[model samples]
Target: MCTACLIENVKSHMLSRRSLFSGAAATAAMGVAAGALSARPVLAQAKGRVVDLTHAYDSDFPTFDGKPGILYEVDKNFDPDGYHLFKLTIFEHTGTHIDAPLHFAEGGTSVDALPVENLIAPLCIVDISARAAEDPNAVVEPADIEAWVSANGEIPAGACVAMNSGWTARIGNPAWRNLPDGTLAFPGFSKAATDLLAQTGAASIGVDTLSLDPGNSPDFAVHYSWLPSGRFGIEGLANLEQLPASGATIFIGAPKHRGGTGGPARILAMH
Candidate 1:
């Protein structure tokens, strides 16, 4: 065979493999949504790379009400009790946490009642960082979702559509959860965007801020609509910058307390 022909054949074979991989990736991305949670689906995460999306929190972590999210009391000291154990007082919805449907919907699914399949599924990151940088109250609008789909293909069903507004960079700053004048200010999911997500059968939404709605939101529109539909939300997520827009699987280590709205979660994404 001619050298040129050989080179062309190799290139064609590589392209074919690339296309096949992309198609299969999209299929497995929504595997859990179809109730396919076998070992094959478990291995759907590509490259075997994992990223921790949870942020460590303490009493000082930012909150929506400007109050500490947790308090600690030393119940036992090593000097006296042979081992130290601190009795902790923690508030649901603090730190990197999941917000169950009950957070907004009456008689909705509680944190412990969320489906296991929904807790582990495709991870889709929609970035609005540039806009969030300029407007603290920026949100993941429908337009943003459209653009993401245009570039990265469709959002898979049962996916966790996370808004990466670059707010993770402001973790310790006053502007992270509030403006200078004591008003809340942070980026979140706009109602229109969540509407699109719901239409696509998305299981959950996430934000790097304290709430699912933008800080200045008057009605919590996204929360009211999205949660009542039986979907969940995650807030105060960190390290979203380390993940990609698609092809990652999220595992939400949700709180198991019965009747709880939600609590701090340890979330991880494997790509």
Candidate 2:
């Protein structure tokens, strides 16, 4: 063959090889794209999440009467073009709030001072709803804690132990406030239970009720024991019946109010 013809033939062969390799590359790319598309349904189906609790907050929602009022009003004319915006004013410890260490301790940590890691932790939910229903002033004692641990492994350190007293059912009723004697009476932890949890390195204590101690008692021994230990408190929580006894991870977020001893928080749980 002539020199020019030979060079043209070589060029044609190189082009054909390049085309073949390009086709193989495109095929591999399509396979990867198909694999990714196939995994989409699996990822979508695996996303199983639910709310284990709900928080109650409103004027009609019953709270301690003598405490500050939770007020909110529309700022009708304030925004440009008359775009109405709501304004809220209330005490930090208004509804579903966290009681930081400083709530009772003189020099202890406040809401702003609490460690970030302590806000979220494992939850050990104790169910005493039946007992609480029998006696309005029921208190969870150390033996109860031991019983719970025996049934569901150990109560891990750095976990929030929530006492479920079924008191949330009475929240909207006329008898939601203090009992007949004029003193609030509900369910909570006893001194022994509180101290045991504090010593065991519980990150915080939570309850689906108004107080960490039985309402009728003037002495808040449970609160006194837990708060002074620098652990946090989660009160006024609702829907404790939805969670399992010992497998949920709780997430707690309090509003960043400066120098606040306590502040309203949004608490959620995940299994």
lDDT of 1 by residue, 107-221 (tens): 9999999999888888889999998889999988899999999998888878899999998899888878888899888888889889988999889999989999998899999
Candidate 2 ranges with C-alpha deviation above 4 Å? 1-47, 65-68, 77-80
**Per-residue accuracy of model 2 over 176-235 as CA lDDT, tens digit each:** 556766677778888889888877778998887777888776888877778988888888
Question: Cα deviation of 137 in candidate 1 (Å)?
Answer: 0.6
Q: Largest TM-score belongs to which candidate? A: 1
Write down the lDDT that model 1 would get: 0.89
lDDT of each: 0.89, 0.78
TM-score of 1: 0.85
Candidate 1, run of 10 with poorest lDDT: 34-43
Q: Weakest 10 consecutive residues, lDDT, candidate 2?
A: 39-48
